[model samples]
Target: MLVLGLQGSPRRKSNTFILLDRFLQEARTKGCQTFMLEVCRKQILPCKELVICEKNGECPLLDDMHDQIYTLLRRADVVVMATPIFFYNVPAQLKALIDRTQTLWARKYRLALTDPKRSFRKGFVLAQGATRGKNLFEGLQLTTKYFFDAIGATPAGNLYYWKIEKPGDMAAHPTFSEDVRKAAADLLDPLVRRRRVLFVDRDGAGLAPMAWAFCQIHAGDRIDADFAGIAPAGTLRPFLETAMTAKGIDMGFFRPQSINELAPSFSPQQVVALGADVMETVASRFEKDPVEMTCWELPTFDTQDSEQISRLCKAIEEKVQESFGMA
Candidate 1:
C-alpha cells in the first residue's frame, strides 16, 4: 500500500516527526511503499477562498501544493497526518493544507463526483502534545476528520502521545515502537489478505476505470479491484466519464496513476491487461512473479462509438467473472 504521511511539525526532527517516521518505517517494513510530506517545508499556499473549486470543481491556485500534494493524496491508499498539538489544535501550516482541501469537498458535494477509490482508502492522524490535557487533541481530531472527508478517506484511526516535549522524547516512550507496529499491521492486514485484486495498465482514464467499476458492481464484496496505468494521463477521459455515468458508476474524482506507484501496494492474484499494449508492459515488468497475467482486448478511445464501448464492457465483465472463478 502507498502510505502518505503529512509531517505537520515546523521544527526539524521534532517529536511529531519522530512518531510519524516510526509509523511510516513500520509500514514500509510490512511491505508498504511510503512517502512523507513535510508541510512546513513545502510551499503550500493557503486557500484564498476563491470559490472556484466550489463552482467548477478545480482549484485556481497553481503552485507546488496543487501540482504535487493533490496528486499524492489522490494516489495514496492510506494517508497519515501527523501534528504536534499547538494551543489545543494542529500547526498553522497543516491547517492551511487542510483548508485547501475544501476544493475537493466542493467537487464531491457540489459536482456529485464520486471517487470509487475513496471507498477503499483510509486516513489516520498522529499527534503529540507537551501537556496532558483532557481535550488536547480534540480540535486536531475534528479538523482531521473533516480534512479526511475532503480528501475522500475514511477516518480509520489515530495515534496520540501526550507530555512529550523534547526532540527525541518519543524515542524514549516505552510503548512507542509497539504502538507504531500495531498501527501498521492493523492498517495492512486486511488489505494484503484480500481474496482477489485486479490491475489495469492504461491511463486508468477510460478502459481501466470502467472495468474496475464493472467488477465492483458484479462481484460486490466478493472481490477487491484496483486500476493503474504505466504512464498515467493524470485525469480520466471525458467520454469515459460520461459512458460510466450511464451504468450508474460515478467517475468524477478519478485520477490517473502509474503502475510503479501502485505495484507495492497490492499483490494481485490475477492481473488483467485492458489491451495488448498493457499486456506487454506488465509482462516486461513482472515477468518473474508467479501471478497470472492475462489480456482483454478492449477498444481504444479512437473508436469513440457507444456500440463499441458496450461490446467492450460486456467482454470485460465476462473476463472478470471468469477470473473470479464465477464463470
Candidate 2:
C-alpha cells in the first residue's frame, strides 16, 4: 500500500516533523511504501471559494494542488496528516491543501462516481499543542474527518499530544512512541490495495467473459471485477453468447476489449491470467510486475458443449474469490 504523509509544519526541524518521521519509519517497517510532501515548502494557494467544482468536479485554479495531489490521493491506500496545532487548528498551508479537495468531494457527490480503491483506503492524523486544554484538538479533528471523507478514506486513528512546545517535546512523553507505533500498524496493516482484480484469457471469447460476468453478479459489491484479452477477438462466438443467455447473464453488448485500450492510469491490483505467457505481457506494462497475478491453465472446451460452458464459468468464479481474497 502507498502511505502518503502531508507534513504541515512551517518551522524546520519542529516537533511535528520528529513525530511524523518516527511514524513513517514504523510504516516502512510494516511493508508500506511511504511518501512525504512538506506542505509549507509547497506553493499551494488559498481556495478561491469558487463552486466550479460543484458543477464540473474540477478546480479552475492554476495552482500546484490542481492536479498533483489528486494523483497522489488516487494512488494512496492510506493518508497521514501531521501538523502542530497553530491556534487550536492546523496551519494555513495545510488548510489550503485540504480546501482544494472540494474537487474530489464534488466527484463523489455530484458526479456520483466512485474510485474502485476508495472502499479500502484509510486516513490518520497526528497533532501536537503547547497548551493542555480539553478542546485543544477539537477543531483539528473535525477538519481531518471531513478531509478524509472527501478523499474516500475512513478516519482510522490519531495521535494527539498536549503541552508539547519544543522541537523534541514528544520524546519526553512516556507513551508517545508506543501510541504512534500502534497507529502505524493499524493504518498500514494490509500494505497493498488488493480489491480490484482483472481477469485475462486467450480472447474474451468464453472463459474470461463468463468469469467476469458471474463475479459481477455474485460478489460485485465486495470486489471490482473486470476482464480483457491478451488477444481480443472483437466479439464473442454465437455459441458462447447463447450459452450466457441460457444462464440469464447478458452477453449481448459484450465486445472484446484490449488491456492497452484502457485508461493510462488503469492497472488492476490483482490479475488472473488463464493462459500461458500472459504475465510476461501484462508485467511489461507495470512495475508491480504481476505480484497478485497468477496463471490458471485449464482444459479448453469446445464451443459446442453447452454444459461445459456452465462448468468453466463456475470454476473460474470459485477461483476468483479464493485467489483474490474477495468477500
Report, for all candidates in order, the number of backbone clashes.
1, 2
Tens digit of lDDT per residue, candidate 1, span 255-297?
7767786776676677878889879988887788778887887
Point out where model 1 deviates above 4 Å. 195-198, 201-205, 213-226, 230-235, 245-267, 299-327
Q: Write the per-residue lDDT of candidate 2 for residues 1-327, one digit (tens) a residue.
A: 467889999989888888888898897776566788888998788888889988866788876775367767765667899999998899999999999888888877876655444656778899999999899999998899999998888888888898999877877778888888887876565543335667777676666766666665565445555677877896776776666655545453346667776423345676777777676776665554554766787667776777876776667767766764563
Report the poorest 10 consecutive residues by lDDT, candidate 1.
Answer: 216-225
Q: Worst 10-residue stretch by lDDT in candidate 2?
A: 245-254
Candidate 2 stretches with Cα past 4 Å from truth are: 190-278, 281-327
Compute the lDDT for candidate 2: 0.74
TM-score of each: 0.85, 0.66
**What local lDDT does model 1 show for residue 244?**
68
Report, for every candidate in turn, its global Cα lDDT versus the true structure: 0.79, 0.74
